[model samples]
Target: MPIDALVYLSMTVFSLPIAGIRMFKISSLSLSIGMSAIAAAALTACGGSDDGAASTREVALEFVAVAGHTPVQCGTLVSGLGTGSAPAQVKDLRFYISNVALLQANGTETPLTLSANDNWNLTAGANQITLIDLENATGACSNGTPATNAVIRGTVPAGNYVGIKLTMGVPFALNHTLYSDVTTAKPPLDIGAMAWSWQSGRKFTKIELTDPEGATGSWTAKTFAVHLGSTGCVGNPATGETVQCKAPNRMEARLTSFNPDQQKIALDVQALVAGNDVTKNLGGAAGCMSGGTDPECAGVFRAMAIDWKADGTGTGLPIAAGASQTIFRPIAR
Candidate 1:
């Protein structure tokens, strides 16, 4: 008989709750069943399992943003731009990146478990993202935030990861929450300057540069701001309602052949603003404002490997192409 059957048979034989009476009632059937139950319990206590639950180990990954070889800073003049444009001084550079993952050698991606950093990261429940702030309003960058965040940290599965992958904007559901209404809104999202008044959404990437030499002749420092965000947003911001976006201009960055332990991921601003005119502003906006018809975006979006004018609609969401390369690259630490 089975162990369970022995337990049932012993229950019948033992008339009272006396311990010795139950022991005396043990027959061959009872011994086999009772021993089987005890053996199973021992196995459970010993942590014996056929499933591979203990294989994954905790891993930490760090992300960094840079300009050329140097770390990005305010008031620093960056030269070599599009069509002989003048040297530009960076005023501010803040952006949001989300959905971090580690690309394995077998072409499988392991999603990271993000721990929120009070200064740099924001995580409320399932939503976790990084706010990279690189300047303050001390010198020429008077409009920038003083709190700088260059390094973003997250935990991943311990293994030989071939690459790192991340998305460059807030998800559509959490993108349009108004600052005033959202008490939980953190740092970069809470900043008023990053909020778009027309669309009521956060700027995915804000890179502001000014020419220090007065070469533009109009202002002492002509502005070149690339505010990447969703356009054609429809809804109200006052009631903490998330608006529907026509374009969720979120760019995906995938750096292949990257080892987080040995290599550092670089977000080169030089490659970002490459082949883009800083001095000229053809439209009302000084730089590419994630607008479909903006002439400035043609070069800016192209260099970033984004399909700007897709489907002949003059507008499209940021699509990730495996063949096209982006500014985010892996370099030795």
Candidate 2:
């Protein structure tokens, strides 16, 4: 029953002369039952007010993977693509994306930590982050890593927030081998795997393109896997930690705070795989395969930013907020 209905019902049940009573104090059971009858309506009327108790808001962060589709997985869905019958399947694909950062309205950063066993908790506000999930994800790689991406939602006091900040993998500080004491001290969980080996450093992701010439045919049966991690990693002889090299491979994805009431933010993998990261700081082959000389792959690894445009569903990507996108197509720039 709604609050209005309950209120009406209570008055109707005891209608008549009883209305002369000064204070009609409600009993425990009556109060409980009456409140229960119309809780949702009451809350709606309250509209998350800060009267006796402060009202909390819940935030929903979803991930979508857009590849063959327009807007991928609403914008952050984890997935892989291929088409075939067993050996004919074009599943020879791999990539690395790490070091998550929140894109505030003004364009600041709220970096997060990712690794095998990371501390950044989705429920807690810790900078911990994880991937959503990939279809047919298996092997040691898929063992402990989260199959679901981190969600930062809760009853936060209603206020103005530009957006969130996070990263994809572990940083140099946490990359120190000394940090991995597997004795009585529990090994700190590192959320960025596939990019990290023990504690080398964050290597965002690896993009592999197979079918050399075309689909499963025409092209050679070779594979080109693009892996981005701190190269030239040297292990500390004493504590057994890997020190950071001068430069490391990385990727940066930025998205303005998606205004729930206004425009929705969308991420498209089709454009991403086909987009160009030609900025001086951002390098990568416009049409090159991975696996060659360090220099050959360096240029292709430079541009590692996934920039979502204003037109998510129409002009840019077809990704949505509630669902994720999964695709398997032969796409290129």
Candidate 3:
């Protein structure tokens, strides 16, 4: 049979007029082809099904801002100064915090790169990392950019991490007096305190003490730097990041050990607010001043707060004797 006759006969058998059936069939097929073409096009635009590589695992570790020298409430400020008892009492309420790490329960720590370090001071609490490099808008802090707290890029293992840790400076072997300079390509390349302090070789942090009697604080302020090693800062004094002058690699620690069963670490920010209990761990204000109180640096460093769930500033209550530091995941997370 001819092709045209076969087409007509088949349409009629299906209980439809030949011409009408033929047009409907063509239109249906055309629509089907059009739909198929669209579907294929959509798939390609969506990065080509099954042709993509492994997905990158990353989590944004955001560091929010809170004033070190005030009560540190979310928006607490006064006379261009932030509200806080201890920091307000001190000459300058700033300390450098860098070399951040995201820890896993498996003893792994992922180090964070320096996002922004404008104005060069590392010790300012609001200086290191935060949501907005929010300024005090009052005094010396006006020109400074609050450090970036959010971890924009970091390699996260495919599991729940328990804690985080990092050395205070660049690794020892890579450090020198020059490394203290944070000039991008400097030897101590990643050292925060050294560069921030400028003069101190590798200061963990600096706290000033004033011995005077007056209505307002006196001008006789004594500067104390927390350097590596012991008094007089003997034995090379850890040029790079870790605890010393001449070491090979960065210090290694397990952040998971801090967490009990995947729980968060909640620090008693209230106690810190009351006045960092410098006496509890470091004996007295005098000892911490010179690292004179031996074997307590770790204790003091441990005393530094890093909670996961608490608000960046905490409840804003004063810390008490019974208050222990709490560490947990941040609520925003």
Candidate 4:
């Protein structure tokens, strides 16, 4: 029942027997009690004081794979357009996005409260971060597990969010711990395909592509893995601990005009490897393994707006200064 109605009912019920008393006394007492009840009802209706608990609005961080302009899925073969462009099937697509914040019009960051669901996201401090699992173990993604997490759900202050800011890697504190030993480790870190090691840390972004040029549904296909993570770290793989990394490789994605409700962030696979030849293997492990020496790392890192050199590790310059503008784009309406 509404508080106002309840208050009125209570006042009437309590004053019924007292109605036979002196008229002025009953009126004065009723007036006093009625005023108090109305005041309490008004406070209850407004949900307490203004600063007690503000209403929260939900923001969804959605993920999708695209080749050129066509939407692609895990098992679908997407064709490229460049000289070495070849039809390739996505084997796995997963990444970690943390410390999500909403940009205010006055240049302030309001941290989002990530909904803690064991599958896709976990509690990181008071806030929440998400492990975006775009594909599961099917078709070319057979090596992966059968858990698809393509959306991140979280709550922010109810208002107009002008922009979105998120980190593309696990925080350093949570990054260095070993999932094997950690009893409370959650998804993304717990998933064997996503977690690399303590030295390398978690694969911040794992994008695996297989060339489907002449073969279909064959396991004997050449695969390329873009395993972006912390490299050049002094750590013990056995203990699952790392002191620090020479190259953090944590890419920051800032969308200046993204409204999480009205639009979604698109991680374009075509644009990410637009300059590379997905058909030909670059020797060793096929593609960039987040190594500084790997020739393929430069283009891939550059695509995400990271200033990476051929030998690995950035030039100590700011990432967004010379980063490529091809990889992360907003989804069309």
Local error of candidate 1 at residue 144 (angstroms): 1.6
Per-residue error (Å), model 1, residue 172: 1.2
Whichever of 3 and 4 has more lDDT, that candidate is 4
- What does the lDDT read for residue 197 in candidate 2? 55
Q: List the candidate numbers ranked by TM-score, top first.
A: 4, 1, 2, 3
TM-score of each: 0.75, 0.46, 0.42, 0.77
Order of models, best lDDT first: 4, 1, 2, 3
The alpha-carbon deviation from the true structure for residue 317 of candidate 1, after best TM-score superposition, in angstroms, is: 2.2
lDDT of each: 0.69, 0.36, 0.33, 0.71
The candidate maximizing TM-score is: 4
Question: Of models 2 and 4, which has the larger TM-score?
Answer: 4
lDDT, candidate 4, 62-151, per-residue tens:
877787678877777778722467778888888888888888887688988888667778776654568887887877888776877778
lDDT of model 3 at residue 3? Answer: 38
Question: How many clashes would you count in candidate 3?
Answer: 40
The weakest ten consecutive residues by lDDT in model 1 span 47-56
Model 3, 231-316: lDDT tens per residue? 22234333444333221112222244433233322222232223332222334333233232333233333333311111222221
Q: Model 2: per-residue lDDT, tens digit, 1-333?
A: 555455655653333445567545445467657666576567656655324555544454444434544433211322342222111122222232234444455665544333335333331234333433332332212333324442333333444556543333334444444334443112233333443553444334433333322344443334333444554456653465436453343343444445433333333333333332211112233233322232333323323332122222111112232122212211221
